[model samples]
Target: MTGKSLADYQKEYERIIFFDQPRKDILLEGLQTEMEKQFKLPMRSKEWKKENQKIIAMYRKIVITRTL
Candidate 1:
């Protein structure tokens, strides 16, 4: 193997998962916008909105970690 550390390898893996792959940004943006409209509040200020963001972020983390 090369001289890179394990953490460096892990970072590369995560980068591939989170950044190298194609994502449906437009769909995600539309969904988030619709959710904000439906809630009538910014996601950071509303309890339900905050919860949804947490859930979405968790899912994103899981997907990236697993895919990596």
Candidate 2:
């Protein structure tokens, strides 16, 4: 949560998923699967609470820099 809305997460998620393969067919559900694998924890897990801000900032940077 960390003061960021779901929309923010969605926007970042979209950019992260499409950064490498913009033409690929990546569903929203697939993003969730990938994120869980990447973060090594479920979204609902307490670990995400502490890492939320860092994760958001990281993805925002990736989107801004376009350096996947």
Candidate 2's TM-score reads: 0.33
For candidate 2, the lDDT comes to: 0.51
Residues 1-55, candidate 1: write the lDDT tens digits: 3344334433444444444323534333433444335434443555654666644
Model 2 RMSD to the real structure? 10.7
- Each candidate's lDDT (Cα)? 0.43, 0.51
Which segments of model 1 are wrong by more than 4 Å?
1-23, 43-68
lDDT of 2 by residue, 1-68 (tens): 23444466568565656544543334444544444556554446565656676664544444454322
Q: List the lowest-lDDT window of 10 residues for candidate 2.
A: 22-31
> Using Cα atoms with residue i matched to residue i, what is each candidate's TM-score against the true structure?
0.32, 0.33
RMSD of each: 13.9, 10.7
Among the numbered candidates, top lDDT falls to 2
Pairs that collide in candidate 1 are none
